[model samples]
Target: MKSSILLLAAAATLSAQIDRIEGERIRPHVKFLSSDLLEGRGVGARGGQLAAEYIAAQFAAAGLKPGGENGTYFQRVPLRSVEVEPGGALTATAGGKSISFKWLDDFVATSHTQEPTGQFDAEAVFVGHGIVAPEYQWDDYKGVDVKGKVVVLFTNEPPSTDANFFKGKALTYYGRWTYKYEEAARQGAVAAIIIHTTPTASYGWQVLRANGRAQPQVRRAAGEPALTLAAWVTTDAGAQLLGLAGRTVEEMLQASDKRGFKAMPLGKIHVAGKFNFKLQDIETVNVAGVVPGSDPKLSSEAVLYSAHWDHLGIGQPVNGDPIYNGAIDNATGCGLLIEMARAWSSMEPKPLRSGWFVAVAAEESGLLGSRYFADHPMLPAAQIAANLNFDSFSPYGRVKDAIMTGADRTSFFALVQSVAERHRLSIKPDGHPESGGYYRSDHYSFARVGIPAFSINMGGEYEGRPSDYAAQKAKEEGSTYHQPSDEYKASWDFSGMEQFARFGLALGIEIGNLEKIPPRVDAK
Candidate 1:
């Protein structure tokens, strides 16, 4: 009975500390970060450097110690930017007839091997989804030797209803476009071409076009297996190429969906490409700060909070707006990180473990900053207790539920549920698992390295709004996401973002005070 009373008192005190976090405090940060002057916070750009400096200033004001290298708040991440020059050609030939594809209109490609000038002429082979999963007993490259061939494949994996097979309807990492390219390189393929379809890629062809034209920043260490050409073609172009060999896109799609699918080489069909690339080496920094714990021994272990501070910098104009401000996409998340750092710094008797805040860079460039941190950590991987990530937050009003994707995959789920119950916020499951929400954000980088991590956000169920409010907001977001129209508005309600930060604070406190670190249930 005495212990129960003490626990109640501690909970009340902790609640009071988190109550200090407010929407008014978070408003100014979001407005400034998403302002036009920031220039979309492009990675390795001047605006990106300014964003990192602003975050470091906020961390200094909160009285937190620097958690980065050399007694400073900056950890440098090295990258190489690859830009494919125009005037390149991709052609498919069969039976003495050839069809040349237009550069950006019909196809886009680059050589990941870092070659300044390269060309490949090889027979085309359809390698079904390009996946090789031993657990599911699946291997698309089973019988055929695809070495020195141009491998053509789809983006996602085969459909499944059983959870044991490729995680059922939820898309696994194996289904990502990155995985497709990496697997092709591993199989000794000279080049890879992905057929873009709305249902498979989860976005329209416009998204691919935008990403393809942009300079891609990559982290390739020495001696990595890479392809001479990684390419994507529209459904129309794919059908045209396949038709040359007497096959339809519909027929190939149906055959690939079944198990034991074999690699089919197109008879007498040859794909060839010639390209020139401009490469530049660049550096970006991850801003990191820490609040030391009160307990001496336990302070060695740490709890991490992360947010990515990047977006699609300057890009093709939409509605005469060329700046991708990324207001709700990530400015809200960084705003919450600043406020949470302030709150954690002011705790009277600090939690048992240290708390670290990191605003990563190059998230829009494929989670590069977070991946670098995971590879080169401040503390040993085993000493880090857990990671609580904040990505894009809703600007709508408060929500009655929260979505903590991938939390159920760790032992922290019980504590997460209890914290949600305390705040009158119900725990909600992922609504669009097929989009692979778990693998899309910065948290996945840590999770990939055996660290327990998950992103925090308000669920679709809002308070004091119409029943269809969530659906309406989702529809509105689809049009603005990654578009220049994603700008900040003073009229937005930041109460939902505030609520998410407070919940994160409470959950982080619980994890920090635990007797032992939470184990990752899915750890191999």
Candidate 2:
């Protein structure tokens, strides 16, 4: 009877502490992280290192244990930067005519390996969308041999424009360019090149170039087999090459839109490039802090709250502003992570499940740091109950509902719904599966290995704003996203951010106190 009374008192105290975590209280952290001094928090840059240290300091101040390497607050993730200098000499021959393409103009290629000045000399074959999903009964390589040859692929999966195709307007993992490259490697192709179109790729050629680099991957000595080269060619360049294969670009695309498409051989094709890449090992960190649980058995289970702190770093100047400060893109998410941790730590008696507050690195480069932790976690994979990720939170205003990016794939909606209702908010279904939000964040790394994961955001039904406020915010955000113009402003609001954080804290507490968590929902 005495123990029961103590438990109730502890719960009450914790509830009061959590209520102290308000949006206005988090303003200082947000302003500092998004400040110009951080230099956009670019991974591998000094600013990135500073950001990691700042997170570590916050963790220490919050009374959380250092959940990192050697009893410290940093998980050192070794990454190699491969800058592929575009002096490439590319040539393709078809219809008895040879065409020389302009480097970085018609296309851009990136390398992740340690090889310098890589060369590609092989036959080129055209494969539709370059996806092979057995579950879907779709195979682009049906009756084709691409081993030791260059395989040409198209971006996106046969256009998931409707529910009839790969989730309909929602992008499956097979639709991403990364998946296209992985599939080519699985097919034993020496080289993989994607044919890019503005509409198909959902961005312009400039978007491709602006984001082109030998995306930093964890420096792995041995892992999955990879293609020798991964390249992208513009639609015009693709048309030139496809024309030589005795098929018009339209004919090939039309054929691609349907299923059971066989690979088309580009007659006597040859692509030559001497890619100059500067490979160097760069060390980064994933800042983690842990709050131990109250119960021994359930304490072994940990629930993760993740947010990426890295952004595009310093890039080409827009309107003479070169730094991509990533104010809303991710800095806000990191601020949320820290403030949430502080509230959790203030509880008199901790919840049953341990809580992991992870601020990962190199998210903009590719979800590398998260992938590293998901593979080599502080605790075993079985101990991680679920993951809730936050990235690019909208600071527009409060909403009547909250969003779950991949809610349909998980049983977690019950808990989220129950908690949201207390705040007079409804649970909103993922409205843009077309954005592939499920496959793009830190939570994905956890979900890939079967840990139930999902991301949260404010729903579009804004209160005290115009009916079209959501649409307006989307349009404005999409316009300046990833550009130098993504700087923070004094006029921006964080009331919605604060309310969302409170909701997330409540959800975390519920999960931490659960006796049996929801079943693991596999994204596949």
Candidate 3:
């Protein structure tokens, strides 16, 4: 009874501390970070550098020591951008009928600079989902001759009503667009285009077009063995292409609902596109700072907190707006980090294990900044405790549950849940696990190297709202997610953000003090 009373008192005290995360305090940071002056924090843009400088300033103010290479808070990432523009019309001849697809309206094409000009007159095959998972006995490419041909693939894995099939409603790696592209490359396909639908891809064609229309793909090098072109098309395009096979897109979609599906050929099809690519080398910086551990022995070991600060800069305008503010997408995340650093700096008891705040760059293009850091970390990979990545935090009311994207993949996830539970908040796996949210962020960059990683967002059960209100709100946000409408608004409620800030800070502290290293996957 005495111990229970003590626990209650502790909970009350902790709740009070969490309540200290004032919206007024976090508002200015979000405003400044998401301001138009920053131009969406695009890679290699002036706004991106400004964002880096701003984060470095916040780190300094928080009293964190520089943990970057040498004596600086900046780790320079050698980056490059490739702009693939439509040189001419994108023409496709199929079923003895030739038609052209509009570059921005119907299809988006990306190609390498190695080929100044080229054409691929290859056979077209509809490879459902482009997946070949031996474990699931699912092979979309099995018994198919795709070599030197252009393949058409689906955006996500096949639907499954059975738990045994592709994790049921939960999307796996096989469902990711990246996986589809990789599979195409491995199959010796000249090029591949994944068909997109709002329901399947979780976002509208506007996102795909906005991402590919004017946005330059960030590439590391002028590499070779490249596909003639890697592309994406709207559902209408898929319908037209499949129509040549005397088949309907819906029929193919239904056929791909589960196991035992075969690839079908669209006869006499030749896909060709003219791509104009201008490549340039650029430098972006990842801002990192360290709150050194109080214990000398544990000072060398560090826990990582990361947020990507880059977004799509100036893209094709919508209603005269082109700046991708990325306010909720990441400004909120960076704001949370700043608040966390502030809370930690003034705490009476410092964390036993060191904590590093990393604001990465080129997250929109890829996880470039985190990738570079992982390759060249100040501390050895083995000594790093864990990674907590923040991205696209909602600014609504307090939520009943914390949604962690990658939490389920590692044993350390239990520790995170425990910390939140102590604060009277429940934690759950990502509601949209089908989106491959686990692998989409910076934490995964660290996780790939064997470190336990977590990417957390606040959602599920909003206060003073319906039980499923969070899910509905998520759907509403999906429409404007990557569009120019992603600007910051003063009307946003910060109650949920405050809850997340407190929760994350407490979780970090708990993980920081633990002597046991975060669990790693054991190799047999």
Candidate 1 clashes between residue pairs 3 or more apart in a chain or in different chains: none
What TM value does model 3 have?
Answer: 0.92
- In candidate 3, list every pair of residues with a backbone clash: 171-434
lDDT, candidates in the order shown: 0.88, 0.81, 0.79
Candidate 2, 1-524: lDDT as tens digits: 99999989866775686686888766677777877898888788888888889989999999999999999999999988777775667778755788787766787776644566677778888888898888778999888999888888787877655675687777888888889888888888878888888667776786666565546766756756677678898888988877777766678777887866888887777766566777778989999999999998999999899999898777656678877788887988898899999988877678889999999998877698999999989888888888888887677768888877765576787787887897779887677666677788888888888887888878888898888898987786666667767767777788888888888888888888888987776676
- Using lDDT, rank the candidates from best to worst: 1, 2, 3
Per-residue C-alpha lDDT of model 1 across residues 18-107, encoded as one tens digit per residue = 998998899999999999999998887788898999999999999999989999999998988777887788999999989998876788
lDDT of 3 at 471: 72
* Number of the top TM-score candidate: 1
lDDT score for residue 451 of model 1: 90
Deviation in angstroms for 398 in model 2?
1.2
| Residue-pair clash count for candidate 2 | 3
Cα lDDT for residue 126, candidate 2: 85
By TM-score, the better pick of 1 and 3 is: 1
Instruction: After the best TM-score superposition of candidate 3, give how far the Cα of residue 261 lies from its true spot, in angstroms.
Output: 2.2
lDDT-superior candidate, 2 or 3: 2
